[model samples]
Target: MLTPSKPFTRRCFPAINVKKGVVMVGNATTFYDGDQKQRNVTDLVEGAKKANVVLEARQVAMKIFEDYTVSWYWIIIGLVIAMLISLIFVVLLRFLAGIMIWVMIVLLIAVMGYGIFHCYMEYARLKGTAGSDVKLTEIGFQSDVRVYLHLRQTWLAFMIILCIMEVVIILLLIFLRKRILIAIALIKEASRAVGQVMCSLVFPLFTFLLLCLCIAYWAITAVFLSTSNEAVYKVFNETVCDYAGKTCDPETFNVTNVTRLCPDATCQFAFYGGETYYHKYLIVFQVYNFFMFLWLANFAIALGQVTLAGAFASYYWAFKKPDDMPAFPIFSSLGRALRYHTGSLAFGSLILAIVQLIRVMLEYLDHKLKGADNTFARFLLCCLKCCFWCLEKFIKFLNRNAYIMIAIYGTNFCTSARNAFFLLMRNIIRVAVLDKVTDFLLFLGKLLVVGCVGILAFFFFTQRIRIIQDTAPTLNYYWVPILTVVIGSYLIAHGFFSVYGMCVDTLFLCFCEDLERNDGSLERPYYMSPELSHILWKKDAELLKSSESQS
Candidate 1:
C-alpha cells in the first residue's frame, strides 16, 4: 500500500516501500498539480517547493517558540503585575469612583481644550510657511501623512473637530450631571459588592479553562474529521485517454484494461473526496463539532455570568452588607447555578449558539459569494449578515440580563428573559443614561489598566527602561512579547472588570426591583444601599419623607 504516513508531528518525508513497490506522497508534502490529479514531474517540483515553505514556516515557529520560552518568566511577571493592578483598580473604584469619573470628564475636557489650542497655534505658525496655504481638497489623498500635516487647512480642520468634540463633551456633562451621579453611585455600590464577594473575580479563570477545553476539543476534532477522508486515485495519461478522469484502485490499477489500452496511462492520487458512508457525512460531523464548540463555550460563559450574578445579587438583596450575606457567596452561588439552573444556562447558551452559528454560516456564504458578479445576491447577503449581526448582539444582551434575572429569581430561561427585558424597558431611561454611563466609566477603567500595563510591557520588552535594560530578555521580536503582555493584560483587566460589570448589572436590576417592591416603610425597607437609594430615587425618597412627616 502506498498510503502516506506521518512519522512525527513536525517532520514528514516521502518514503519508497520496496515490499509493496508502490510510490506514495507523504501527508505533509503532498501537492496536486491542478484539479485533483498530480502530474509526476510537476508534483515533485511543487511538493519540493511546498516542503521548503513548510520547513521555513517550521523554522519561524521554532524561533518564536524559543523566544517565548526564553521570556516566559518575564511574560508571567508582566501578567501578574497586570492582575495586581487590575485588582487594585477594581478595589479603588469602591472609594474613588466618583472622583475618577469627575476627573475623567474634566481631563477629557482639558485634553480636547488643549488639542484645540494646539491646532490653532499650529495653524497660526504655519500661516505663511511654504505649502502651508494648500487646500486639503486640492491634494485629495497622500501616502505621506506629513504632507497633509504641513498644510494650514489640516490644522484648521483639526481645530474645528477638536472644538466640536470639546463642546459636545462639555454639553453632555452639563446635561447628564445628575445621571452621572447616579451612575457613580451604582459603580461604587458594584465595587462594594465585588469587594465583599471577592471570589467572584477569580470565577472567570474557571470559565477561561472551560472555554480552552472546548476550543481544544473542537480543533482536534476538526483536524481528525478533515483528515478522515480516503484518498481517491484517478487515471492520468501523458497522451489523451478516454478513462483519464475515471477512478481506479491503486493496488490493481496496473492490471486494469484502461492501462492495458493506454500504455502511457498511470494511476495517481487525487483529492481526498471519498465515497464511503462515514466519509460522506464528514461535513455534517464537522458542522456538529463547530456547533457543539459554540454551545459549550457559550455555556461556560453563561455559567460564569450566572454565578457572578447570583453572588452579587445576594450582596445587593442583603439589607446589611456581609451580615445578611452567605458565608461563601461565590461557592454557594456556583452550587446553586449548577444544581438548579444548569438547564436554564444551557438553554440560553443554546439560543446564543444557534444565532452565532447562523452568523458564521452567513459569513461563510458571504466569503463564497465574493467572486460572484451578482449584485443582488451580494446585497442580499450583506443585508443578511448585518441583520444577523445585530440579532446576535441583541440576543447576547438579552441573555446576559436574563442570566442575571435567573440568578436572582432561579427562573427558567424564557421567564427570566421576559422579566429582565420588561424590567429594563420599565427603567429604559435609567438603562440608557445611568447604566450605560457606568459602563463607559468601567470601560475607561479597563482601558486605563490595559494602557498602563501595555506601556510597561512595551518599555520592558523593547529595553527602553534603563533600570531593566540588562534584565530584559533578548528576543527575535520584541513586539511578540509586548503584544502577548498587552493582550494578556487586557484579558486580566477584563476579567476583573467583568466582576464589577456583573455586580453593577445585578445591583442595578436589584435596585429597580427594590424600588418596585419596597418603600421606606419598616415593613418593606429597600435592600439597596442608602447612598444608591438616595441618589437614584431622590424624588421618591423626598415624597416618602413628606408623607411620613404628614403622618
Candidate 2:
C-alpha cells in the first residue's frame, strides 16, 4: 500500500465465523495480501503523478549540474569580467559622478518611454484580431502566462503602468534636483574614501566564506539528526480493531494476541520514529541547528559591516587626506571589531535571528494551513507574515547603522543602536532624500554590471554569436549556464558596490556629526570635503575659508 515497487492485483474472499455464520470478511481479506493489495484509485493516481514529478525534477537537476560542470570555465570568465567592470565603474565614479548620475537617470526615463511605446504598438496591433477583445476576468487565470499576451487589455494595462511610472520619475527628478546634486557630491566623496582603502572591496569574500561554513555545519548536523530515528512498526487492519495502531514486532506479530483476535490484521512498517528520548526531541535539535545557522550567518555579515564602517570612518575623521589615516586601516578596523565588538555583534545578530526565526515559523504555519478552510486563520497568518517581513527589514536597517556607530564609538549594541537612531532622526530630511538617492544610484550601477554580463552570457551560452558558437559547450538546457552567470555576476557586482555604499553612509553620518559638534574655527574645523560643505552650507563658505586661511 505504501510503495509502488510491490504492486499486485487485488483479490477478495469471504470468511466463515463459528458464531456469526458466514462473516463479511471480503474487505478484511484485502488488507493483509501476501500477493495482492487494494488501494483507492484517486490515491493511486496522485501517487503516480507525484512520482513522475519527482523523476522529472531529478532529471532536470542532473542535466543542470552536468551543464554547469561543462561550462564552469566560461561562467568564471563572465564573473571575472563582471568584477573588472564593477571595479572600473567605481574608479570612474570618482571623476564622473555627476555625469554618470545624470546619465543613469536619463537612461531610466528612456527605457520607460520605450516600454510605453512598445506596449502601445502591441495594443494597436492586437486590435480587430479574433479573441483579442476577450476580457481577462472572463477567461480567468491561465497556467501559461503567454496566453494573457494575446489579450488587448494586457497591453493596455502595461502601457498605462509604464506611462504612470515615466511621469512619476520625471516629476521626482524635477522636485529633487538639488538633492540629486548633494547625492552626486556624496557619491564623489564616497568614491575618494573607497580609493583610499582599496582592501575593503574584498571584505565581502571573507563574509561569504564564513556564511558558507555556517551553512555546511548546519546542513550536516540536520542530516545526521534526521537520520537518527529507528524504524517503527504498527498494527494495521482494514476492519475496525482494538490494535489498529499499537506498536508491534513484525517478527513476533503472528504469535501475538492481536493476530489471534483479528485474523486479517498485519504488522507493517509505518515510518522512521523511535521511543528514545533523543529521537523524541529531534525536532527541537533541528530548530536549534537552524537558529544557530541564522545567528552565525548574521554575525558574519555584521562583522563585515563593522569592519567596513570603521575603515571608512577613519577616512572621514582624518584631518589630512592620507597622512592622518592609519597605514593599514582595513586591517586595523578588522582587529578592533574582532577584539572589542564581538559580543555586541553577537547580540545584534541574535536579535535579528530571533525575528527571522519567527518569520520562518510563520511561513511554516502558513504552509501547513494551505489545505485548511479557516478564512480567519489564513487572514491572521497573512497579516503576521507581512508584519514580520517589515520588522525584519527595519531591524536590518537599524542594525547596519548601529554597527557603524559601534565601529566609530566602541559602544554596546543597544547604546549604539539608540544613538544611531536618534542621529538619523535628527537629520531626517537628509536621510530621506540624499541617502536613498545615493543608494538608488549604487543599485543602478550593480544592475548595469549585471545587465552587461548577463547579455554577454546569454549570447554565448545560447550560441547566438557566430564567432564562438562552434567553440561553446553544448548543453541540455542553455539557460542553466546563462542563469548561473547572471546570478554570479549580480553577486560580484553587489559585493563591490556595497563597499562604496558603506563608505557613503559612514561619511554622511560623520558629516552630520561634524555639523553638530564642530564650528568653522581652527580648534573645531569641519572634516568634510570642500565641495560637500559648499553644497550643504553655502553661507558658511566664507567662515570655512577664514578658518582655513588662519590655520
Candidate 3:
C-alpha cells in the first residue's frame, strides 16, 4: 500500500534524518483545493513545524528561534519555575477582575432598587388627584417645588431604565465571562508581568519625554505668536480706525473683541467657540488652535504609540524565552524604538494624516454637493466618498499592525505592513476570532470598572448630602461627583486595558511566528508556552493518529 504523509512532531523522532538534512515524506507542495475541506496554509505551516522542519531562511527568523531554544536544559527548568510564580500573580489579578464585575452588578441592582423606592415615595405623597380643570396656581406647593417634582419624576424614570440596561449588560458579561477569560488568559497574565516593566521603565521615560514636548511646544507657540504677521498689526492707524485703536490686543495675547461689530450673525466672540477670526489678532489664536496645536497633539500621540508598541513587543520577545529575561527589557525596547522605528511611526502618521485629509475633503464636498441637481452625479459622488471612507479605516488598521511589526522586527513601515498583512491573511480566521474575543473582553472589563466607580461615587456623595427621605433635595446635583468618578474610572480603565490590548497584539504576532518557525519535536524543540503547547498538542496528536490509520 502507498500513502501520503505530512510532518507531525514526535518527541522520539530525530531532527534530521541521516539520508539528508531535509526529511522528505511525500509531495509537500500540492494541496487539495476543495472549498468544503481546504486546509489552511497556517495549519500546514503549523503541521510542518510539528515535524521539526524549518521553512523560513531569514536570519531574523533564526534569531527568534535561537532565543526560544537557548540553554535548553536550564530554559525548561526556568519555564517550570516561572510558571509556578506567574500562576500566583495571574490568579490574584483574575480574582480582582472577577470581584470588580460582581461589584458592578450589585451597584446596578442598588440603583434600580433606589429608583423603585423613590417611585413609591412619590406615588404615596400624592394625597388627592386634581382635575384637569384646576389651574396651576391651585397646586399647594410653590412653583419651584412643583417644577422640582416634575424633574424628579423624569429623573427616576431615566435612572430606572439606565439601571435596567446596566443590569442586563452585567448579566450578559457573567454569562460569557468564562469564554472571555479563556480567550485572554495568557495575554492577561503577560500584561501583569508587563506592568512591572512599564512601571519600572516605560512610564518614567514617557513622562520625561512628555515634559520635554510641552516645553518645546510652548517655545514654538511663542515663536509663532511673535512672528506670524497676523498676530500684531497696528490698528491705531488713522487709515484703519477713525478713532485711534492701539494694536487691537486683548487682556490676553492674540485675543480681543472685534472693534468693528457687524450685523447680528456676522462677527464672532473673542473667546469660546469663536466661529471666525473677525479680529485681526484672533488669527494667531485661530492658527494655534487649528494648525500648530493639532500637529503637536498628533505628534505626541504617535510618539506614545511607538514607545508603547516597542515596549510591549519587547516583553513578548522576552516571554518567548523566560530563562533569558533581561534586567532592563523596557529600556532596551525603548532605545531601539526611538532609534529605529521613529521613521516608521512618522510614516504611519503621514498615512493617517493623508487619509484624514481625504476624509475632510469628502465631508466638505458632501456639504457643497448636497444641493447639486443631478441625481446620477450625486450618486457617484456618494459612492466615491464612501469608498474613500472605508479605505481610510483600513489604512488606519493596517498602519497600526505595521507599527507592531516594526516594533518586533525593526523594519521599515512598508515592509512591516506587508509582512503583517500577509501573516494575518494566512491566519485570517484565527486572527479574527482572537481579535474579536480580546476586544470584547477588554471592553467588558472597562465598563465593569467604570460602573463600579460610578456606583461608589453615587453611594458616597448621596449619604454626604444628608438625605431626609424627600429625594435628598440635592439628588439632582449628584451627577457632578458621578460624572467625575466615571471620567477618572474611564481613564484608569483605559490605561489598564491598553496594556492588555498591546500584549495581545504582540503575543499574537509571536504565536504566528512560533507556529511557522519552531518544531516542538523532542530532539530540537522549545514550545511557545505551556498553554500554547497544550493547544497545539491536541492538534498534533489528532494528525499523528490520522496519518497512522491511513498508513
Candidate 4:
C-alpha cells in the first residue's frame, strides 16, 4: 500500500472538511458547496446577499424606468397647475424678501440710534451735580456711588467720540455699496440653488419634533444630575459601604450602582476602597442616564437619517419632471421608514453606535496619554488613533450612502451598504469627482447662510439693548450675542444644507444606476426623469423618441 512517493493522509480541519476520506484542498479552509464546488461560508453568504441586492436594484430600475403615459390632457393639466403654483411662490418670496430687507435696515438704524442716545446720556451724566456720585451699577458691586465717584470726564468724552466714530463708519458704508451689491448677488445665487431642493427639506420640519424630544430629555438629564449629585452626597454618609457583602444600606443604593453599593469581597478588602465612593456617585449621577440617552439618541438618529434618505431619493426621481413629481413624497417616505425599514435602521444605527463608542474610548485614552514623553510610543499611538478616526469617518460616509440605497431599493442596511460600496468602487474616480464638487458647493452655501444669519441676529440683538449703554461695564462677556448667533446660525445652516447634501447624494446614485441599467443611446434611453435627462445630456435627448419607439 505504501510506495516511495506515497504520503499518508492524516486529519484535516474537522470543522471544515467534515468527511474524513476527502482530500484537503489548499489549507483545507474551504468546504464543498451544494454544487460540489469548493466554497467558504463567507463566500456563500456574500453570494446570497449580493444576489438579493442585485434583484432589489433591478426592481428599482424597473419601476423608475417604466414608461408612463404621455397623454396630452395630463401634461397640460400638470403644467398649468405647476406654472400657477410657481408664479404664486415667486411673488410671495419676492414680497417676503422685500419685507425682511426693510426690517433689517430699520433694526440697524435702531441700533445706531441707541448708540447716539447713549452718547447723549453720557454727556448729560457728566455735567450733572451728582455726576461724581452717580452710581454706575455696572462697574462693580460697589453700587453705592463709589463707582460713579471714579467716573472721569475723559471717560465720558471717549464714549461720545466712540459713538461718533461708529456713526461715521455707517455713513462711509454708502461708498462701499457696490461691493455690498456684489456680495448680495452671490447670496441670491446661493439662495436660488437652495430653493431648488428646499421642498425636500420640508420633512425635516416634522422630524425636528423628534429633535425637540431629545432636547427635553437632555434638560431632564441635566436636572437629574443637579438633583442627584447633591442628594447622593448629603443622604449617604461616608461609611464602610460594600453592598456585595451586604455592608451598605439597601435604601441608599441606585440600580446602576448596585455593584458599588454591593461590592464583592475583593473590592471590599482592596486598598482602593476610598475610590469606591466617587465611583458609586459617578454611577448614580452620570452612568445610568448616559446609556439610556445613547439608546434614545441612536434610534432618533436612525429614523431621522432614513427619513432624509427617502425624501431625497423621491426628490431625485421627481426633481426636474414636475409632472411626474407626486404631491408630497415626504409623507410616503416617512411611511416607508416607519413601516418597512425600522429594523434595518436599528441594526445600522447599532453598528454606527458601536464604532462611535470605540472612537470615544480611544479619544479618552488619547487624552489620558497627553504628556507621553516617549516619541516613538507617541508616534505609534498617534498612528493607531488616526487609523481608527479615519475608519469612523469612512464608515459614516458608507452608511449614509447605504441608507440612500435602502430608501430606493428597500433592502436591509447591510445589503444596501454592500451594494453602494461595490458600485462606488467600480466607479471610484467618478464618485470622487462628484463628491468633491458637491462638498464644495454645500460648504459655500452653508457659509453664505451662516454669515447672513449671524449678521442679522447681531443687529437685531443690539437693537433690543437699551440706549443708555449703562450696562457696558457689566455687559455679559461682550461676545454672548456673537456666540449665540454663531450657534443658532450653525444649527439652521445644518438643517437647510443637509437636505441639499442629501439631494446631491441621492441624485448621483440615481444617475449611476441609470448609466448602469440603461444604455443612454437612442434605442435604449435613460430611466431618469425626463427633465433630468434632457438637462444633463442636452443633445442626446433626441434619443427619447427612439427609446419610446423601441419600448
Candidate 5:
C-alpha cells in the first residue's frame, strides 16, 4: 500500500525522464537541443563553395596549360617571328641596294663625261693635222681616227652609263627585295587559297561546261534533223551529185535500180556482196562525199580528236603522283584545256560553217551548171534526209561516249591527241608486247608537262633580256645582273605562291575531313569548359543509371 502511494507522489528519479536533449519519437519542429546541426549545415555550404572555387582554379590552370601545348598556336607564333625576321632582312638588303644604285649612277655620268672629252680631243688633233702631204695623209688618217674615236667614245659613253645604272640598280635592290618578297609571299598565299578553292569547284565546273556543250550539240543535232531545216540537206545532196560529176539518175544509185546497172562485169563484181554491201558502200560513199565536200568537217574531226586526247593525258598526269598534285596546276590545266577546246571548237565550227555555206554556193552553181533536171531536183528535195542521217550518227556517237568528247574539249585537242596516242600504245603494247607501256606513257606525259613548263620558263627568261634592253637603255651593259635579278625574282615568287597554295589546299582538305566526321550537324559545342564537361558527364551517368534501372 505504501509503495503505490509513494510511487505516484515521489517521481523518484522518474521511471522515464523526457528531456529537450533527447529526440522525440513523433515529428517535431526542433529535434536537437544545441546549434551544432545549424553550424554543420552552414559549414557544409561554405565548404562546398570553397571546394568549387578550388576546382575552378585548377581547371583554369589546366586549360591554360593545354592551350599552351597546342602545336598550331606555337607554329603560328613561330611563323610570326620568322616573318618579322624576314622583313627585317629584306629592309636591310633594300637599304644596301639603294646605296649601290646611286653610286652606279654617278659612275655612269663620270664615264660619259670622260668619253665626251676624249672624243673632243681626238677631233682637235685631226683639225691640227691639215696642209702638207704628210700632214694631209696624217690629217686623213686623223679624220678616220676621229670618226672611229667618236664612235668608240659614243659606245663607251653608252656602256659606262649602263654600267653605272646597273650598279645603282644593284644598290636599290635592298628596297626592291622587300617588295619582291612581299609580292612573292602574297602570290604564294593566294595561289594556295586559289588552288583549294579551284579544286573544290573543278568537278562542278567541269560537269556544267560538259552539260552546256552536250546540250548545244544536242540542240544543233535536233535542229538539223528537223524537217524544217531542209536547206542544209539540199546543200549536202547537191554537193554529192556534183562530186559524182554526172546527172546520173537516183534509179542507178537506188536499191531498186541495181538490176539495171549490174550488166557489166565491173558492176557485177562491185555488187557481188549484193544489196547489203551496196547499202554499206553507199553509206560509206555518202559520208566520204560529205566530208570531202566540206574540208572544214575534216578539220573539226581532227581537232576534236586531238583535244580529247590532250585532256585525258593532262588529267592522268595531274593525278599521277601524290606530291605532284597541286590545285593551281590542275586548275590551270583545266582552264587552258577549256580555252583551247573552246577556241578550236569555235574556229572549227566557223570553218565548217563557212565550208557548208560554200557547199551551198557550189550547189547553186551546179544547179545552174546542170540542165536543171527534175532528177537532180529530186535529190535536192531529199536534202533533209541526208542531214538527218549524218546528225543521227553523230548524236549516237556522242551519246554513247560523251565523256570522251567532253574530256577532250576540256583538256584541249592537243592533250586529247596525246592521251589517245598513249591509250592506243597502251592497248597495242599490252596485247603485243607488254602491259607496262601504260606506265611509260604516264611517265612521258608527266615529263612532257614538266619539261614544257621548264623550257617555257627558260624561253621567257631569255626573251626578257630583249625586253629589258627595250625598256632600259642603261640596263644594256648590265644585262647579266638585270636578267638574273628578274628571273630570280619571278622564280622566287612562283615558288612561294606554289607552296602557299599547296598548304591552303591541305588545310581545306583537313577542314573537309572534319566536316565529314561531324556528320553535317555542325551544331554541337566545339569548345567546352571543364566544369561543364564534368557536369555533362555526371548528368549522362545519372541518366544511364536511371534508364538501366527502368529497363
Candidate 6:
C-alpha cells in the first residue's frame, strides 16, 4: 500500500486556463488569466519611440521651410530682374525721344485743328438752339474777337514778348555752340560740386526733418487713440463698416446690443427701431474723421513737395551740357532721369491718392450714418477740426524728438554732400583728362541698369506677387517654396552686381583720396587704381605714389 501511494502521480492537477482560452496541460505556473491584453515588450517600446521621432521630424521640416522662404537670396534675384527690364525700357525711351518730339508736334497741330472745329460746331449748335429773337454770332467772328481780346491783354502781351526773347536766346545758342557748351560744362561742374556739398549737409537735415515728421505722426496717432471722447472711434468704426461690411459685432465698438438687437443680420439703425447704440458711436466717429482728414491733407502736401523737387532736379540735369558731350549720351541721360522722376512721382501719387480716398470714404460714412441735418457741412467742420488737432499734435511730437531726427538728417546731408562733391570733382577731372566716349558709356550703363532694376524690382515684388493666387489653404505650405527659388535667383544676380559696384566705388574713392592727399590739382587721374587694393592691403605708400602722378 505504501509503495502504491509513492508511485501514484498525486492526481494530476486541474487543467489551468491560459490566455486566448488555451488550456495548460503541464506546469500550472505557465498559465494565467489577466484583464489587460498581452503584447511584446520590445514592440511597445519601439512603437512609442517611432511616434516621437515622426513628430520631431515634422517640426524640423516646418522650421527649415520657414527659414529658407525668407532668405535674402530671393530679394536680390527679384531686384536684378527688375533692373534688367528697367534698363531696356529706358534705352527704348531714349531712342524714341526724337520721334516723341515729332509726334508732339503732330499732336499739337491736331489739337489746334480740333479746337478750331469744335468752336465752329459749338457756334453752329448754339445758333440752332437759340430763340428766333436772339441773334447768334458767327463762330469765326467770335473766335477772332476772343483772340484779339487775349492779344490786347497785358499778360498775353508779356507772354508774347517772352516768347520772342526765348526765340532770340535759342538763335544765340545755336550760333555760339562752342561758347554755350563751355559755359554749360563750367555750370554743370559748379552745380555738381554744389549739389555734392548740399547733399552732404542739407540732405541730412532734410532726412532729419522727415524723421521728425514720422515721429510726430506716430505721437499724434497715439494721443488720438488715447482720448476718452469716443468720436474718432465711432467715425472709424462706421467707415470700416461701410467699406468692409458690417458682418459681425465689431470688436472695436464694444457694443453689446449688436447681438441682442440684430441676432441674424448686422446691427443697423433700421433693425433696432433707430434706438440702437449707433448714435453714441457716431459722436466718437466724427472726432476720428476730423483727424484723418488732416493727416490725408498733410500727406498730399508732402507728396506734392516730393514731386516738385524731383521735377526740378530732373530738369537741371537734363538741360546741363558738357563741352564734349555726345548727343546720344546726353539724350539718354535726360530720358532716364525723366522716366525715373515721372515714375517715382506717379507711384507715390497713386499710393497717396488711395490713402486719401480711404480717408474720404471713412469721413463720408461717418456723416451719412449719423443722419446729420447737413452732411456736407458736418464733414467740412470735422475736416477743419481734424486739421487743427493734427497740427497741434504734430508740433508737440516733433518737439519731443526733434534732436534725433535732426542728427539723422545732418548725417544724411553730409553723406550726400560728400558724394555730390566727389561726383563734381570727378566729372571736372574726367572732362579735362579722360576720353569722353569711354567715361560717358560707362556712366550711362551703370546708371541705366541699376536705377531701372531697383525701380522695377520694387514694383514687381510689391505689386505682381499680390496678384498670384496659390490655391492652398496656407501660404507657407505652397507659395513659400516657389518664392524661395525666385528670391534665391534674384539675390545671386544682385550680389554679382553689388560686388561690381563696390569695386568701382573703392577704386574711385582711392583715386580721389590719393589726389586730395598729393595736391595733384588738375593733373590727377579721374579714376583710381584698377587693382583690388582694398581687398588686400599691400604697400599703401607705393600705391599712393603710383596713383599720384597718374591722376
Most accurate candidate by lDDT = 2
- Could you give candidate 6's per-residue lDDT for residues 1-551 as a string of tens digits? 00101111455332234445445445534322132233333443466678767776787577556645553454556555654543343233334433432343344334334434544444444444434223233223321222332222323344455456445534643554333333223222323322322222122234335546755765676565445333221222322233224433345434555434434434322122233455567546655654444454444333333322322223223323222323333233234434433343333333444445455665666667576688687777678658755655543323212211111121232243344344446545432322232222223334334434444343343344455423112322333334444454344334332222222222233334444544434553322212222321233344446568798
Candidate 5 TM-score, C-alpha based: 0.18
| TM-score (C-alpha) between model 1 and the true structure | 0.72
Q: Sorted on TM-score, highest at the top, how do the candidates line up?
A: 2, 1, 3, 4, 6, 5
Off by over 4 Å in 3: 1-181, 195-296, 319-321, 360-389, 461-478, 522-527, 535-551
Candidate 2 lDDT, 143-251, residue by residue in tens: 3355788899999998999798778878878976766777888888887888899888888899899999999999999888887888889999987688999899998
True-vs-predicted CA distance for residue 165, candidate 6, Å: 49
TM-score of each: 0.72, 0.77, 0.56, 0.50, 0.18, 0.22
**How accurate locally, in lDDT, is each candidate?**
0.82, 0.84, 0.56, 0.56, 0.37, 0.38
**Least well predicted 10-residue stretch by lDDT in candidate 1:** 13-22
**426-454, model 4: which lDDT tens digit per residue?**
76744644554445444544444444555
> What lDDT is reached at residue 450 by model 5?
31
Candidate 1: regions farther than 4 A off: 1-70, 100-175, 231-273, 474-476, 539-551
lDDT of 3 by residue, 1-551 (tens): 11123333543332222134455335444333222233433455566665443333344355444534432343333334333332333344544644443444455456556655656565455435444234444554431223444433444565577667767766766775544444555454455456556443225346446646765776777665545444333343323233344343434422334444311112212223223344466554744444443344445555565556666655555545544556676667667877777777776776676666666667778799888898997788789888888997898678777777887777898998999899999877456555666666666656655655555455554555345334332333344444655665565566556656666776777667667766767764644667556744454455457658999
Best by TM-score: 2
lDDT of 5 by residue, 34-54 (tens): 221312233444667788777
4 versus 6: better lDDT goes to:
4
Backbone Cα, N, C clashes tallied per candidate = 0, 0, 1, 5, 27, 38
lDDT for position 450 in model 3:
60
Stretch of 10 with least lDDT, candidate 6? 1-10
- The ten-residue window of minimal lDDT in model 2 covers 11-20
- State in Å the error of residue 356, model 6: 4.0
